[model samples]
Target: MNTTFGGKPHVLILGGGSVGLTTASELRKTLGTEVAITIVDPRPYMTYAPFLPEVGAGSIDPRNVLAPLRKILPGTKVVTGGVSAIRSADNTVVVTTEDGAQLEIAYDYLVVGLGAVPRLLPIPGLAENAIGFKQVEEAITVRDKILANLAEAASTKDPKVRKRLLTFTYIGGGFAGGEAVTEAEDMVRDALRYYPDLHASDIRFVLIDAAPFVFPELTEDQRAYVLNQLRERGIEVKLETFLNSAENGVIKTSDGDEFETDLLVWNAGVKPNPILMDEESSDLPVVTERGPLMGKLDTLADLRVNGAEGPIDNVFAGGDCAAVPDLASGEGKFCPPNAQHATRQGKRIADNVARSVQGRPLVDYYHKNLGVMATLGMYKGVGRLMLGDKEIDVRGLPAWAMARAYHVYAMPTLGRKAAVLAGWASNLVSRRDIIGIPQSADPRAAFELAANSGPKKK
Candidate 1:
């Protein structure tokens, strides 16, 4: 390995998300001062994505879902920047810091965990109007938007305006969309108790998906059960449907359904970071085929980048950005880009990197998925746990409990876990807080207006 400074191998990680955070933590713990570690990301904090649904529903505080990178990884260097280009041939990466300063950092080893972004379509007004649900801020916006709409609908005497404000349309029915729509619906239901003028029937939730069913990960019976539960809550489940246009608050669907919605959430899917596919930005070998796993870094089971013949030297990648082979499922199968795989792959890659530094044989990553779980509102959920070769299906309260337990265990720090648990416990005894700080979206607006106001003459 090339040593750039202090005669120690400098490991540069290109993301501060699940994989990056785990890898950095483990490397610091295992290698100590033997290696110099640096993590570069646009955000200084790592957002725990699984609890985003609860955060959107006001069940969890947004702060509880974020762990600061600097505080968590004390010994490692944290750079708040976005990578513009990866010049692996020169052993340097070009990064643009938050303040727009460019830097070229040299590293002996490179770890790619840049993760994915929303796979948006070219539908009309989609980019301008649709809200995303990927990060903690987006989750907070979703919560605030829903609450703000409800409050506005309650005061509006115009029936058409009220109907439009109360209608919330969600596109895509995957795990993220399914949980998000359901949880948002629950919040509206709970908040209706406070508004005597608004009833449950006044609010409308429409979930649209291009597929025939939502939660394809669930079994046939389980999927049916989820659909039934959602319909029972008065949420219109429109499967085999697509959003044709979302122009000017009017939603036009492929099924010829037209409606006006105040809020539109796009959670269809995600693609690997654009830098991985762009030739100018990255020279890495990425799968460019037109498929579900397209535009991902071609990686091996040992978490090393795939070269023309074999693994590349000192270049490792895992997480949503890499097409890692699913060794446990045999050949021709790749691991799904999910948090469950990303977190485990992080630990594996860290150990393998340490082994490479010590001149030891590296180990392959293989782990059977433990289960699939989704929460529907507070105490309702669905889960499928893998017990050996058999599958155990669970729903309702037990599944909800299991989902919470799993997330608490999966969350990075004990402090964050305790905070999340405290929020959930408090909600059990008190009513859900329906107050929306819409001003948070533009916190400086009021101050800016005051500053522009002309001084009054005495």
Candidate 2:
């Protein structure tokens, strides 16, 4: 470790997600002005991921889910780029900036919270057509795309074409997929109320999952309740089913069913950041087929990366990128890759890093997961709550309220929290905005093209 720091003991964090920002916040508190902290991420803000479903549903404004890193982490030097490589051999990181420039940063301490990317399968047409359940842009694009379908449906006369435009398919039964389908269903239903031609029955929401149950995290009762709740609203719940192919706007399932649709949400799961497995990050010896591993950087209980001889001396990692052992769980169990675990782990790792720098004994991280919840759109939801020594299942409005309240509390800054609350409050009185705005995706195509062409120069 760099003992002599003229207030510049560089601490480089590889992500800007929940874990990355939390680590920066805690490190500031623990290290004070002793070390220089820098965080590099592809995005300028830390997305409040739990609100992604609401964003897609148009229940929350897109900006509400984004907490600007500059505004949130004041003392930290935030780099708008992705870490292309993490070479632990000499404590150096290669960052590919947003402008396509490469910058190498030498760090005395490293925190690899690179986070996860969507797990996409080799399903036909999925790569070219389907939208992901991650990222703010994905949520926005989904909202626009679904609305665009409605616009097309509203203007069409042919039954088949209308049906094709209105048909929606979601592949995956996890929280992302569950929440997305439900929210989209809700949004489209709301939209149909205002459309003169499109009837409620015209829109078909199909949720297909390979698993028997939609949410594996939910209790049997909760799962049954959600399934029934969705079906009651005309949403099709097809379990033990797989999407065989989604090619050329034709969606074919393994159940010998085929349909044409413009929308398909792929939210199967996520693998750890591919950067860990890339040639740039090869020197760390901290990667596996598992993507993220605790022993990769060979981290000790105190968060210091352990090498063959002893502590690698400076590098530390957590979040979805590390396999930190879950001290609260039973023997040989690692923390689950979730916001709850990652947030706590990030803070713990940060504090330990500060202590390690100060030549003090480091402490191990331990935190029992308080609960897990998934919103089912509007006043419906499901969750497992941990109270005292007992764990209880909640559903319906109560579950919805609990989930919203927790997410609001956890949403980064007070400004963002207030913005989200305001959006929700407004939603209660006014109907959802159903205008199709796919141009938001490109944002500048029209303007750029117009500018390129001489503007009334005659």
Candidate 3:
């Protein structure tokens, strides 16, 4: 609204993740300087999820994986806040800004691209003890916590304390889950080589999941290979297991096992944004059965908001938040929330939005399924690449390169690409830093103690 647009329509984009930013990028090219665009997200940046494993491994710098929303969108307005409520009927959004101030924003169009959150279950103490691999900060913190555990173990001579400090349990065997587990384990084991007091066996890295195999997209053979490789490294893989509870580093599983550990990484699954997905309470037009958008739009073939009959006017959705029909699946399945589809959906969303506003013929979105890829660690990975009619199964170095190449090629902004590339190149030669900063369990220990203290105790 502050920018000079000469009465041109304003577009409000919710969330600054892959879909929202992509929509903004494409919109800039499609609508030019005529239209006003505003993007709202709780954080100021977008965390490139694919590189999170490397971040946890200390292979890539954390700064490189985050893309600042305002920095990327030069002329567009970037609101740093969470969307508390969407007044669709009034074309207004209630946003809680970064400084905690509330603002009511009016828009001619609304784009719902609020990405998903980690799908958490009501397992006891799971919420308090387990950390996820969703954001840049979480990834970096995991790395730091692992390194800190090593330092803690090294500083102590007690075997029980050292074992508890060194044990790490990861839940989930999906792409993010596997990548985070393997990559972090690799880094930790390599760090063990430097410690005179520690052996690789001293560090227990256990991966627990409800699935019998890892990497859902990979062939059975590939999954077996991954399994074998992990076992060969002395990593514990527990399958078809349910996590019962976790508290004070003690993990109780459904498989009649008890483990004490200092860390737990939960990558079970992700649900759509909680507030938006709440059908009973939320005003957001989310389909009850569809769950939280999960990064796709409930749109027509042309990416317009789907009404009971046809496209609705002025409303749109895209990214992991939309239940977009997967044309590639051909089974009436929605597109799985992934980078490839979200990136493609963003462009089409922008184009369709422009066309709708201009009273022009809309373009439908249809994309063939691009095969999936996952990296285990540096120089280790598995991928299914689809090129024309040839389907390629890549493993080891080739798969690693393929994964890196695709991610770097897809990573937004030349600066971010360069940063990741430089960090990776540096990683090949530089020694991994073992320093870890401790995260306090009590966030306000000093404040509480101070308030309780009056002069000196008698």
Give the winner by lDDT. 1
Candidate 2 backbone collisions, by pair: 286-296, 293-323, 294-323, 298-306
True-structure lDDT of candidate 3: 0.83
Question: Local distance difference test, per candidate?
Answer: 0.93, 0.83, 0.83
Q: Which regions in candidate 1 have their CA more than 4 angstroms from the true location?
A: 1-3, 448-458
Q: Estimate each model's TM-score.
A: 0.98, 0.93, 0.92
* Leading candidate by TM-score: 1
**What's the candidate order when arranged by decreasing lDDT?**
1, 3, 2
Question: Candidate 2 on 293-354: residue-level lDDT in tens?
Answer: 52234446666666666777677777776667777776777776788878888898788778
Please report the TM-score between candidate 3 and the true structure: 0.92
On residues 1-458, what C-alpha lDDT tens digit does candidate 3 reach at each position? Answer: 32334588898998888889999999999989878999999999988899999899898888888898989999999988998877766778889977889988888888888878888999998999999999987888899999999988998989999999999999998899999999998898778877888888788989999988877778899999999988887889999999999977799998999989998999998877776755442454555554434423456666667755556677787666777877666766677788888778888888888997788987777888768888887788888888876888889999989899999998888999999898777777876766776655456878998898898777
Q: Is candidate 1 or candidate 3 better by TM-score?
A: 1
* RMSD of candidate 1 to true structure, Å: 1.3
